[model samples]
Target: MNKVLISADHVITGPADRVITRGAVLVEGGSITAVGTAAELDTSVEPEVPRLACPGATLLPGLIDCHVHLAFDAGPDPLRAVAEADPGELATAMADRAEQMLAAGVTTVRDLGDRDALTVTLRDAIAAGTATGPRVLAATAPLTSHGGHCGFLGGEVTTDDEIRARIARNAEQGADLIKVMASGGALTPGGPRMWQPQFTRDQLRLIVDEAARYGLGVAAHAHGTDTIEHCVTAGVRTLEHCSWRTAEGIVYDPPTARRIVENDIAVCRCVSGDWRLFLEQMGPERAEAMAGVIRDMRKEGVRFIAGTDAGVPGARFGDYVGMLEFFSSLDFSHAEILDMATVHAAHALGLTDTGTIAPGMRADLIVVDGNPLESLDSLRAIRHVLTAGRPIGM
Candidate 1:
């Protein structure tokens, strides 16, 4: 196995309990063999091995975006774009988006929805090293109620049997995870209200039960309070959009929050950085209230995983800087911001490996030019990206 040494002024090891400091990492055969002080490794190894040195720079695990829709173009009318474009066009566009994401220091991503299951094909291509892109966990299609949000992508079911059939088909098609739209969405024109529960409790339960039977994790898109509770009760592995709403104003029940904490169900906030569009759609008062609720949820002991709902209107891939800034606006410390995008985000997708820089893990890493600890915005200053120990062509 050929070895490479990378030395940096600061290494933010994403592993738990690791302190940030100056260090060097030894990579051999696409796995990190050692990480320690530069003096420590240099004194022990041969003097002639080439070393890529980056003084005053910070090295950390590559970032992960857990919620994305590669089929949508993140434009004014993303669904309409998907509806108009052919499969080949969408695939090529998705490949471009994936490369852009890698250049932004995102090494792994989870695509929650796609049309015609093209995400699976792209994922396979990237994994085979035939394409330059991030490691992908693709959801074949999101399950939804008839005429519900994103139902156009297929996988709508009216009965438990139909739900099982859809799950089987997704598994047969090589999906990495299962996604379900438990509530209506704002993007789907004339769809059910965003706060309305789209599926019956029984139907949701059956989906979860069957998905578990196949060793597959599920991410439920739930915005309403009732739907969030229903998804939790059904043992959903991950909850997306978790933006709760009700008829009598927004509800924030402490018991329900505690249940999510106890059940260890990861929650993705799916925050958006399009301040103008959000203000226009929600008005100033409602938008402020929604933002406040998200902050409160974080305070109430609910685990918040970072995801930008990329490919939604105005939410572009490789633009996670907006999400980091959003978290900063919420008063999250720099450490918290990085954790949400790195280690915590990986756990939300049921991915145990490839989140951190460590021995015996996949060599998916990013090299930045500045200290992200000093300024989260430095993430955009990507210098190099490596997947499986091979440099990604920019």
Candidate 2:
């Protein structure tokens, strides 16, 4: 068994609200053995064990991205690229993308979409130590209506039997969860408009039922108001985007928002890292409308998790820290923002062992040069990262 002790100036542990100054964590066999003030742990470990001491840094649980697509290259036309690349080429690109995510201190990611079930292959490779990357909960391919959003990824299913069969295929392929496209999207040109509903209420319910039989949670990609209502009524576990878009404009349905809060369904609002560019593209009127909707949701006490929607145009992997700034812009406290990336995100993804620094937890941690509680920009200055007690070469 390998053992290592890491000491830092401050340690943020468990919930984002708690911190320990002059803290140290002991790792044994890829699990945290202890977490306490450095003085308290100084004499408890073996003298021969390796120790890493950083005098002015903060240690935190590795960040989690609730939604990402490892297969897309963040190019202007990721859909086109996916269509052109063979399976091998897509897998190689995904491997490289995963490394970039690890380097950025994203230690866990939920890949919500991919081609040829490539994300599952990368997920397994990373688990077996054959590849270097974050712990991945891969969806393989997302279920979409025929010719609906993201239909080109080959997850288009129309009938009830087809839906159940597709769900079974993904489960057999080792998918950690299921992703369903509940509405249209901007990425798929000439598809259903962004505010248009794709899956019927019955269809969504069937998907949730089938996924539940396999003990897999269903995450719905919902941007339209009608679609969000459908997903909430269908018992989906998580709602991605949740933009509340209508053909007239952005609208916040209080009843739907209340239902989401009451049911404890998590909402992943994937703000682009280049938000300023996004605002410019969206123009002032539309951006303000969207921000207003988010503000209303926050006021309604909806649970929000941080996700960059990485792999989309203008949203790159390794930009999770930049994406945090979007939450900050919404006037969220730094602690609340950190919780979204760590504790809340972990709960959303059903990852119980790796979200926080504590005894019995997986030793997935990151050290930064400054205090993220005071300034989120500090997170970008990553000094070191450990995933499952294994140091990632920076």
**lDDT score of residue 35 within candidate 2:** 92
Error of 2 at 24 (Å): 0.9
Instruction: Name the lDDT of candidate 1.
Output: 0.82
- Would you list the C-alpha lDDT of every candidate in the order shown? 0.82, 0.91
Q: Name the 10 consecutive residues with the lowest summed lDDT in model 1.
A: 13-22
lDDT of 2 by residue, 1-394 (tens): 9898889999999587899999999989888999999988889888899889988899999999999999898999999999999888889989999999999999999999987788988998998989999999999889998988899898999999999999999999898999999999988988899889988999999999999999999999999999999999999989999999899988889999999999989999998789988988899998888889889999999999889999989899999988899889879899999999999899888888988888999989999998999999999999998889888983
Q: Using TM-score as the measure, which candidate wins? A: 2
**How far out, in Å, is residue 197 in model 2?**
0.6
* CA displacement after TM-score superposition, residue 140 of candidate 2 (Å): 1.0
Span of 10 residues, lowest total lDDT, candidate 2: 385-394
